[model samples]
Target: MTTEFSPRLFERDSEIRALGEGLLACALPREAWTHEAHLGACLWLLSERPDIDVDAEIGGIIRRFNESVGGVNDDTQGYHDSITRAYVAGVRLFLSETTATSLVERVNAMLLSDVGRRDWPLRFYSRELLFSVPARRGFVEPDRMPLPVAHK
Candidate 1:
């Protein structure tokens, strides 16, 4: 349960905020998962719990996608491809170069591996996880700070 912090993680605050805002904007209707939002969600997860088994977790996501969507075809393959790309891009953009490179390599390897062959039914999975799990588990949103008390 130790947390890992990186300056690179904080540097992407604006991007994370924008993505979160986008999710909020689409709050009425379910939002599609986007690269930015997924990246933001992963970034939050990494900062909060660096010990997480990313490969296993994402592999499970692929499995969930398979169960939910059935088989991949011409229409759905693009979404799978996009999710892989987004997963790599998110790691690269939000993490330190060394960490990002290692993660991207691992994720790329996973994508090449048999288990990573699936993708989600809806992109909102990342958004749902981002918005729901942390709150329910009592995890604080990364980069959020308490407001300072006002002086009279």
Candidate 2:
């Protein structure tokens, strides 16, 4: 999304765009849906696809992709809304003050940042609250810290 996030993963903006395109079309293989890919697609959506209302569309997008991959969005698995939205918020914050000019560079730098970590949200949300069924189903406020975007 922002420049390349990880040199080992994405080398160009088009690659990230392709990831978003495949995801949007439900054409990406389940095995290709890695954590980095998730962030990559979201970053593409956030940074390049301004036409998309990411906050509103992200859940449906995830649900559709999950179903296409035979993943169930039930109480225990798939389509985590809280985590998704939190990352959107985090990505927004990161991009707002970013210095990179290319999408790929920004993504790589972001991956190198704290927000790139799989456990980034844990800094704001308690493990119990973040991984709860409610959290997986819908957006839940952070119990540990307010999101920087939410501070507005």
lDDT of each: 0.38, 0.87
Name the regions of candidate 2 deviating beyond 4 angstroms: 1-8, 150-152
Please list the residue runs of candidate 1 whose C-alpha ends up more than 4 Å from where it truly belongs after superposition.
Answer: 1-32, 62-75, 78-86, 89-94, 97-152
TM-score of 1: 0.32
The clash numbers for all candidates, in the given order, read: 1, 14
lDDT of 2: 0.87
Query: RMSD of each candidate?
Result: 16.5, 4.5
Which candidate has the highest lDDT of all? 2
- Residue-level lDDT tens digits of model 2 in 1-152: 33444424578988888889999999999988888888888888988899999999999998999999999999999899999988998888878877888989888777778778788898899999999999998899999998867222
Q: Give the Cα RMSD of candidate 2.
A: 4.5
